[model samples]
Target: MVATTASTGALPPDLFDTTTLVSLAATLVLLGAGYAASRQFLPKDAKNSARVLFVWHAFDALIHLILEASYLYHCFFSWIPASSVTAEDLGSSQFYMPQPSPFLGHADRIYGPQAGAIHGNALAKLWMVYARADHRWAGPDLVVISLELLTVFIAAPMAIWICYDLSMRRSRANVLMLIVATGELYGGFMTFCPEWLVLSENLDCSNFMYKWVYIVFFNTLWVWLPLYAMYVAISEISDAFAVRDALAKVKKSN
Candidate 1:
C-alpha cells in the first residue's frame, strides 16, 4: 500500500490543500445550529448555563451520530479483496495504507476507513482525509475501533439525553454530564496515550494541518469541553448540597 500511496497523488488542493477547512466549517455550522436551537426552543427565562450546555451537547450528538458513525460504517461495511488490490485501487486521495497492513496481511479482504480512497465512496472519504493525518485511522486498528464503538453508540445518545435534560431542568443532568464527560476525557486519553507510549508510530506529524489542526486541535475539542462539563456538574452538585444543608438547618432551628 505504501509503495503505491505516494504514486496515488496528493491531498485535495482546495481548503488549504487539505479538507481541514471543510471539516472546520461544518463543525462551526453544526455548533451554530445548536446555538440557534437553544435560542429558538429553550424557554426565554432559561439560564445561560442551560443554554450553553444544550448547545454543546446538541453539537456533540450531531458530530458523533452523523460524522463519527460513518467511520464505523466504513469499518463494518467497506471492503475489497486484498489479493486483487492494485495501484488503481487507491486513487487521488492521499490516505496511506501501511505496507503489509496488519489487518489485511492475514485476510482475503481489506477493510478500512480509507474506503473512500479505494472506491470513491464520499462518506468514507471524509475520514480518509484524516486518515492521511493519522495512519491508524486508515485501517482497522482495534483500539480505534473499540473507542469509536463507544463514541458512536454510547456517548452520542448520552449527549442527546443531556440536551433533553438541560431543556427540562432535570437535576439528573448533572450526574449524566459528570459521568459522560469523565468518560469522554478518558476516551481522549486512551485514544492517544497508547500511541504516545509507542512514540506515535501511526501518527503522521509531518505537517501543520495534520499535526496541529487535526491531531491537536480537533481531538482536544472533546477534552476541553468535557472538562467544562465536569466543572458544571460539580458546581451544581455542590450547590444542591449546600441548599439541602441550609434547609436542614432551618428545620432543626424551627
Candidate 2:
C-alpha cells in the first residue's frame, strides 16, 4: 500500500483520485440496493425493527463475506511474483507497483509481475486503492487484519443467522443480537483507536473524503448502529423478563 508521499507543501494530485470516487460510488449503490431489497423481500408482517435489523445485518454479512474476506485471503495467500521485490526491500518507498494477479486456485503467469513489485489478488488491489488514500494504512497493518479475519469469518455468519432468527420472531434472537452488537462495537473501536493514538502523525487529513467520509463516518457507522441494536436487544430482553415476572406472580397468586 502506498503511504504519504514527500510533502511538496501542496495537495497530492491523486488525493481524491478516480479510484476513491469509484469505490465511494460502488459502496453507496450497494448499500442502497441492499436496503431496498431487504425492504421488498422481508415479510410484511414483521416489525419495523425486525426489518431494519434484517437489512443492516444482512448487508453487514454480505460485505464481510465478499469484501473483507477477500482482503483476508489476500493478506495470507497473495503470492509475490518471483521476479518482484520482496516486502522487506520495498520498505517505505513511495513508488507504486502493480500487485500480481490474485491467486484463484492457480496463479496466472500471464498477468503476474515479472519483477520489481509485490502483488495481491484483485480484491486486495481494490482494498489497497482505499488504503493508499489514507496515510494510516499505507502497508499491511496486522491489527486491522487480525480483527477483519474474525469479523469476516465468525461475526458475519453469526449476524446472518441472528437476522434469520429475528425474522422468525425467536426470543433468543435478542441475546444473539446483543452478542453480535458488542463484537461490532468493540471491533469498530479497536480498528482505528490504536492507530490514532500511536500513529497519529501518519494520518492523512488532506482529503475531505478520506478524513470525514472514510475515517469518521464509515468507521463510526458500525459503532452507532451496533449501539442501537444493543439498545433494542436490552429493551426487548427486559420486557421479556418483566412479563415473565408478572406471569410468575399470577401463578403464585392462583
Candidate 3:
C-alpha cells in the first residue's frame, strides 16, 4: 500500500519547506469552523465548555501537524531543529534510514503490529523500504503520513461530535457514550493489531515495554477520547430534543 511508503520515494524535497505553515493555516480554519458551529447551535451557557474542547482539538491538531511536518523536514533536511525535536527523535531518525529501533527501552512507546495495519505502520515501512532500497521516500510517504494523522486528529473528532450531537438531541447520552467508548476501544485494538505482525513477522522489537505498553497505551488515547466526546454530544442533543417535545405538549394543551 502507498501508506507503507515514504515521501522520500516520490515527492520532491522542496515540499517540506513550507509544510509547517500550511498545516498551521489548515488547523486554524478547522478550529474556526468548530467555534462558529457551536455559536450557531449551542445555548450560550453550553458554549464555554464546547469552545474549550474545540480549542483543545485545535491545539492538538496543530501539534499533530507540527510533528509530521517536522518528520518530513527531517527526512529532507537530514537534521531537525533541537528545540522542536521530541525524545522519539532518535527513533524517527532511525526510521528515516529505515533502521529498526535502537531504543528498545522505548519500543512500548512506539512500535506494533496494529501500526503496520494502519497507514501509520505502512508509513514507517515506506520509509524503511526507501532507505533500504536506495529509493527516495517522497510522495507515497506524504500521503501515508497525512492520511494516518488526519484520521486520528481530525476525522475522529468530527465523528465524535456528530455522534454526540445525535445522541444529545435524542436523549440517548448513554447510547452516545457507548458508541464513543466502543469506537475508541475498537480503534485502539485496530491500531495495535498490526504491531504484533511487525514484531513477529520481522523480529523488529527489542524492548517489550516500549513496544507494548507505551506505544499501545498512548496511541489508543486518540481513538478513545474522541469516541467518548461524541457520546457526550449525543447525550446533550437528546436532552435538547426532550425539552423541545415537552414544550410542544404544553402548546398543544393550551
Candidate 4:
C-alpha cells in the first residue's frame, strides 16, 4: 500500500537556497513600496477608499476560492487529465496512476489515511505552513481543505451578497462593509497567531515559509470570515425590526 511504503528519505531541495531569500526580501520591499505609492497617489477620503477596497477584496476572495477549489478537486478526486499527470511513463496501464505531486498528491497523504508516515516524512515539510497554524490539532489539512471548499461554495456567495447590498444601500452597506472588513482583517491576523506561536516553540519548522506564513494566513479565513458575516446578518435583522417598529408606531399615531 502507498501508505506503508517508505519514501526515499529525501526532500525536494530548496529551489532557491540563497537566491530565494534575496527574492523573498525583494518581493516584500516591492509590496511595501506599492502600498506607499497607492496611499500617495490614491484619494484620501475614507469612504471612497473603503468602497474601492471592498470591491477588490470581494473579487480577490472569489479568485482565491476558484483556484483553491480546483486544487482540492484535483487532489482528492484525481480528476486532472492524463496529460497533466507528471509521471514519466505509462507503467503498463493506459490510465494515469496518480502518484503524489507537490500540489495534489501530497494533500492526500497528509490528510488521508497515510498521514502517520506523512507526518514524519521530509515531503511533509512542504505542508509546514498549514501545520504551523494548527499544530495542536495535529491535522489541519482536512479541516483547512474542508474550509476552503466551504469558502468556495458558501462564503464567496455571501461576500458577494454583502457587496451587492453595499453598492445599493450606501449607508447601511457601508456599516456592514466596515464590520466585515474589520472581521476579515482581524481574522486574517488570528489565523496567523498559531503560526507565530509554532515558530516560537519550534524554530526548525520556521525554515519552511508555508509553516510560519502562508498556511495559517491563507487557511484561516474560513474560521473568521463566517463570524463577521454572522455579525452583519444579525445587525441587519435587528435594523429591520427597528424599521417595522417605527412604521407601526407612526400608523397608530395617525
Candidate-wise lDDT, in order: 0.76, 0.64, 0.42, 0.43
Off by over 4 Å in 4: 1-60, 77-147, 170-212, 219-226
lDDT of 2: 0.64
Among these predictions, the greatest TM-score belongs to: 1
TM-score of each: 0.85, 0.77, 0.39, 0.41
Predicted structure 3: lDDT: 0.42
lDDT of 1 by residue, 39-138 (tens): 8777889988788888988898888898888877777677777667666655434445633454534466677766544687665666777876677777
Tell me model 4's lDDT, rounded to 2 decimals. Answer: 0.43
**Stretches > 4 Å off in candidate 3:** 1-55, 72-146, 149-209
lDDT of 4 by residue, 52-98 (tens): 44444455355445444544443354333435323453221122223
Q: Candidate 2 residues 60-110, lDDT tens each?
A: 887788877766665455544434445564443232232334324334321
TM-score between candidate 4 and the true structure: 0.41
Alpha-carbon lDDT of model 1:
0.76
